[model samples]
Target: MQKRAFTLIELLVVIAIIAILAAILFPVFAQAREKARQTSCLSNQKQIGLGVMQYVQDYDETYPTAYYYKNNTATVNGGSAGGYVHMSVLINPYLKNAQVWVCPSDALRGVGPDNPACADWTNITQIGCEAQVPRLSYIPNSSIMPRKRGPQDAPNVVSMAAVDAPADVIAIGEMTDFSNCIFLGSTGQQNNERRNKSHRPVNAIMRTAGGGQWAGQSVADVTGPIFAITQAAAQGAEGWGGPADTRAITNTAGCRGSAADGGLHIRFMSPGRHSGGSNYMFADGHAKWHRFNDTINPNRFLWGRTYFPSGQPVLDQAGVQVR
Candidate 1:
């Protein structure tokens, strides 16, 4: 019976060992979890890319229009309205999973009164009128079209074709808010509450034709310059102006200024923060982590100069061509 006695020192040693192990293994576990999430996000982007490719095959060679206006009121130069298509909807059939509409890392999902959780995507629908269309969380390169006033403005229309392989062209990128689709230069301009929260100064970079003062005087408004054409075009879309959807990442440090509205922003699959890296699926159908600043070239990132009145460039992480 006396052999069963245990000393306090023995118990303390055991507890110390456990504490040490926990300190060592906790980070490893956390890293592993993040890695898994990142992989899943990449897969989602690849599937969406495939969906875009499928849509292209079904249609002539053109990609889905990033966002279509419903009525004639929102027309820049008397273009037809309605039938606006966002990359999210275009690829919905291809991804075969509506959940891909949201990024796993976005913290804004289901956060504030305005924030909808990633799971609530079931209720998420494209917003806009026939003439004035809304913005989507994602945009496709195939959807990028010439900004000419013509018959291309129709419902479910595929305007632009992928100039390069599916892997070379960007399929989807982060959209500011659904309201960003509204024309920034017109009376339809609606101030987005998220704008104040966005890391980028939406009002400063948005550039209203009336020359109104930028909204919100917070010093935290540190959005980068609106670079790249495609990003600028996507951002220029009536609804493309707004704050970053933090729900996608769900964390503050990973938050970035919303991509320039118009058609230049590329929506890629991202899950959690990758140490300032996001997941993107190239036209070649491969997923990789693109450092936010890794622009090896500049031409690949430009877009929408001839279409929109503003000829801005959407620069990539490394200042490469992301138009």
Candidate 2:
């Protein structure tokens, strides 16, 4: 037994070797875990894209509208009246698993009352029908033709065939927290009780650009905290519209003042969890990551013009129509 004793110096060396091995292995393990999560997120997007395609096929090749509004009234079922069905409901049957709605990388998951439930498929009771919850991982192409409004009547729902697809048009991408409402924008009007009404239709698309009574003004207004100049500038130039438009990185000089606070700009610049970069599915149905500061011509990114008013080209970089 005496002969079997390990010297103190030998024991110390062994301990140091084990510590070094653990230090080396721990990072490798963490990297592997992150890689797995990223892969799963990609798979989730792929399935979501397939679901969208299926919905389009059955619904006359139309993409779902992200928001809808009527004569000073939020329609029933939100934007469903405008043929804007939530991508969640449109793709629910195809996904076959509700769990796919919440991405594993999203830290905001399960923070709301609807923990573990798919946010997009269900409406949040607290927000009324006008504010349906979103899945947060995917957004339908906003470039699709919007419903046409008449002089004194509700907007006539236009079919999706009216749209033209551009090469770089975004079809789907990651979004922020589902229930946070930080991105909803201004609701317009003070203490507007009408904003609290339930969606007129059972499956309407909630208006992404409008906030609620307490939030004041249309989501387009510059009064809210999310739309402050500093916040907007920090988000990116015209960070109001899409993933590539977010200010998560590379704030441009052009992004100062109202341009920073503009809803449209904010939407254009919002980023995904990847920070300086985000994933985008093009009109052709292929997905890729785009950097926030990439200076490619904006016209190449225009997916469709049918939704914009005649002669109003979709604005691109430099704030001019690309087409």
Provide the TM-score for each candidate, comma-separated.
0.54, 0.57
Prediction 2 TM-score vs. true: 0.57
Q: Which candidate achieves the best lDDT against the true structure?
A: 2
**Candidate 2 global lDDT:** 0.40
Q: Give Cα-based local distance difference scores for all models.
A: 0.37, 0.40
C-alpha lDDT of residue 25 in model 1? 100
Q: What is the lDDT of residue 212 in candidate 1?
A: 20
lDDT tens digits, residues 1-323, model 1?
Answer: 45786689999999999999999999999888878866776676677777766877777756655433323354342322222223454456566565664556444331111122223332223333221112223333322422222233322232333243344444344333323221222222333333311111121122232222222122221133333322222222222232222223222222233332332223222211454555655444456676533422244432221112122333444444344
- Candidate 1: segments with Cα more than 4 A from true spot: 73-85, 110-166, 174-272, 296-323
Per-residue CA lDDT of model 2 for 80-193, tens digit only, reads 222222345545666667666566766555122111222343432322222333434554443342322222222333343444553455555555432222222224322212
